[model samples]
Target: MTKIADFRAMTPDQLSDELLKLKKEQFNLRFQAATGQLEKTHRVGEVRKDIARLQTLLRTKQPAA
Candidate 1:
């Protein structure tokens, strides 16, 4: 559950790192689902949205840099 303001406060490098971390979590969540080991199913959607947010923010920031 990340806020847009929190993402906006981060530097581009920090945002990239956060995006990578979210992607890893997304992978793990997918694996868990495949194995039927996932409990909090809603987290997958959350991570996906967070990753998208980071990507969008990065793109918006890039044009200004």
Candidate 2:
């Protein structure tokens, strides 16, 4: 789980990379659940929150139009 401060400290590029990685994990987790192979049920919520945190951090770093 990524702390909000950790996400805030990362550069936008780094945040993007992490976001992509988390999204991949999220996909895999969903697939596992569908196949009845999921181990850690709580991880889904953790990843979801982490993805949202990264996105929120990235958005805050962007320049306004």
Model 1 per-residue lDDT tens digits across residues 1-65: 89999999999999999999999999999999999999999999999999999999999999664
Q: In candidate 1, how many Å is residue 49 off?
A: 0.3
TM-score against truth, every candidate: 0.96, 0.96
Candidate 1: stretches off by over 4 Å: none
How many collisions between residues are there in candidate 2?
0
What local distance difference test score does each model get?
0.98, 0.94
Off by over 4 Å in 2: none
Superposed Cα RMSD, model 2:
0.5
The TM-score between candidate 2 and the true structure equals: 0.96
Model 2 local distance difference test score: 0.94
> Which model scores highest in lDDT?
1
RMSD of 1: 1.3
